[model samples]
Target: MTTATATTQAPAPAGAAAGGNTLAGTRTLIRFNLRRDRVRLPVWILALFLGTLATAGNYKELYADPKDRAGVVETMDSPAGLAMSGPRHYLDDYNFGSMLGHQMLGFMAVLVGLMSVLIITRHTRTEEETNRAELVRSTVVGRHAHLAAALCVAVLANLVLALLLAFGLSGMGIDGIDLSGSLLYGFDHAAVGIVFAAVAAITAQITAHSRGASGMALAVIGVAYVLRAAGDVGSNGALSWLSPIGWVQRTYVYVDNRWWPLLLCLALAVLCAAAGFVLSTRRDVGAGLRATRLGRPVASDALGRPFGFALRLHRGMLIGFGAGLFLMGVMYGSILGDAEDMLQDIDEIQEALQEIGGATIAESFASMVMVIITVVAVVYVVMAALRPRAEETSGRAEPLLATGLSRTRWVGSHLAVAMTGGTVLLLLAGLGFGISGAASTGDSGLFLKLVGAALAYAPALWVTVGVAVVFFGWFPRASAAAWIVPVYAFVVGYLGQILQFPDWMNNLSPLGHVPQLPAADLSWTPLVLLTLIAAALVWLGLEGFRRRDLETN
Candidate 1:
């Protein structure tokens, strides 16, 4: 029996199987996330690839002449250019395709970072916060599945973007398309997105709430972007290389095309994701690594009021957005002197600016800046107006309504804050720009000029607020869809100009109807009409909200 006995291997323990089941439900969760983002992801992916194609195609025509190319190279290397588009050492070689890639590399990275943040927040903390995770977790789902699925979708989106960029650039028929450089360029963008996805994942674990996680992650991005801009514009390049944005730039795709630096992003992403997974395992469900502290025991009298409560909830986000716009104003103001000189000799650039906004360069600059600022306000207004939906979904609205508060009064309170906040944010942006402009020019009049210009966008802001209110009233389940209004405005205002789309297409933006102030006359007719229309929409919304039941989902 001993001689006939065969050696047998020990079976693995059941605990080992359980330990390996952390990703058990990842595929199902991924499908769920994808379904939720079906429209959103494709819209964004299409925009990314289309923007890349447009940039590649347009630059060939925009910089066909060597003289024009030289101007681009010179302007891009200058402080303003460096700040706007980081030092694209690739432009030193004067390849139009490379310059095109340089133009959008950082901005595109930012867009993807935002996308990643929103996606992760939607899945992880949001699910847990809303108790959807509880039901899902009660099943055969794994603990790590949600975060892993979100990351997987983001990575997939990035991969698609990279492939699109590579293919789009290759087929554009531009000279020196350099497939290696183009593909590497695409890879660089993907790397930046992956790093930010990891960053969002880690942030999602550290804060107990989704809003806190989003705010913290966005703050980090803001700081990193500023740091990169500082380094790019600084005399020494040391600070530039420290930023992830700068590292992406340092790759100098299409110039040296060196890929060694990309390893930095990869390493950071791996470490961040690993840290997030480890932290997630350590924390309890629906909780964070850091426990939240209790608020003050006594509430202020003002906090009892609806407007005050709305203000309190939104104040921090308002401050964050205001600070960012102010910094942007400062950057734009700093560049005015150089922008004038840089575009002075280029007839095409001057013509484009004139067609884009005002008769004079200063007026055009102010109008364009306000147009962008107005888009920011649009987002703020929409988010503010939809706050009540968040409350309703979270069951907080039930208590408030139970207190005998009228639906109209409650909804009106939120709208009031939203409309007022949008106005205040615009003022802050205007003041920031005006003060910066005045400082740059040593003229007090510029402040009034810029401030007035920003105010002209008020009607546009009101319309966005109205749109959000309408959604909140009738389609509370889809109130967040109101954000698409700003997306449309942003695309039309910026991308429409680049692609030189038809006038009818460009005029679709509410900002488009506002007369180019300071450069062109400010007409009262459109403003009055727009305001009336916005008021009508609000009236309709209030009536609907008053009649409908509070959204439970």
Candidate 2:
């Protein structure tokens, strides 16, 4: 009996146990986050890296002569060029390195920042929305562990990308692109990405939904870009200093190789991250600082219908994308009036314009801009079409389906919105482009021409949405694969012209089949064929979804 006596120990109080463990499981979470993003991280990093290399190679080949390089300075010195590219100061040096810094750095930095924002939103707010963060926190995980892991993973991804960019450019052996300049260029991208990651962390605390968090962060990036663009085009360069994107652009990689601007980026990152940590302490697990908009006390009659419900869900996206595409069209059109004077001296561009078979340089440029606008509209199509899959995975679809709502009608509602909404987006874009082109060139005919050119791609856009439907119906888990349609289209439609890819390569994309309107002829044959293909794909997807099981969480 005496030997059987044993001592029992009580566990420590939770408050005491978690006092100094705000980041207790950070390392484990970081490793887990890395594993989750393994494939995605590599794809983003590789695409950006390869694209940079290809662009650099193209520039080198295009401007092999110093005199030809000087012609580029003339185009880039203008206000439109400054707004689209970077500061005009790069024109003073006008060499290979300066060209890259002036034209590529700001654009690449924005992409890098977008990458960071998505990474943070996916790992932090997305997990919380899905209720995974609640489970993670019930264990040894700390309040800040999830955000910390997200930030660490973003930092790691950016660092790897920066290293690759630095070493790869230095190894290219370009005349003016030396190691020091390359290092500055690479690290500047990393700094911009880090700052955005911190911004996302703070935004994640504000919105309970992942989409809201990512949207807020992306809006910040867009504002920064606008500020930088406006400031760069202004007489005095002081306004540029207000933007993080401009901060990195100010590094002036090959021109001045200034390192001080990087310090500003780093300081902002630290301050934002600190604020995020403080905010996390104030919010509860699986909850946002700002509560989600409360639903109506009673459901409306419209909410009962599939189409109405789908419209409600997609309303925000439609408004945001419509406004964005319209603005983008205006921006691209503003540059069209100068296409002849700007591109005539650049032999490669002239060759590309000729390849498009335009009667005039401006028409060829309009055709090129149409490709960009159509591709951007396709982004909206894919996202809207894939909304059903997101709902299913989030457990919302199961409840709606448990009622009398048929699966076909439910899915069809979303697809309808996606298809019709995309067409409307194109219409807005065309109208904006036409208005701007007519104003800029003082020719009302140019407005109608550009509008028709933009609308000509609508059939291609339908095909894109059809592709997304097929994936979502048959391979719900692999629905994201549909993005390849738009991505490939962009590569073929835009870069294919620049890199001189074979016609066969371009023809592989549905977009390639459409006539380059206002540049060449407007042929209805491809449009008819494309419309038939789109209908067939949509019908097949609906049938497949009817036969398949619901993919509810």
Q: Model-by-model lDDT, in order?
A: 0.80, 0.89
Can you write out model 2's per-residue Cα lDDT over 373-404, one digit (the tens) per residue? 99989999999999999999989899888989
Clashing pairs in 1: none
List where candidate 1 sits over 4 angstroms from the true fold: 1-20, 345-349, 355-359, 441-443, 477-481, 495-507
RMSD of each: 4.9, 2.1
Task: Tell me the spans in candidate 2 whose CA falls farther than 4 Å from its real position.
Answer: 1-19
Score every model by TM-score.
Answer: 0.92, 0.96
> In candidate 1, residue 418 scores what lDDT?
84
User: How much is 57 displaced in model 1, in angstroms?
Assistant: 2.0
Clashing pairs in 2: none
Best-performing candidate as measured by lDDT: 2
**Residue 373 lDDT, candidate 2, scale 0-100:** 90
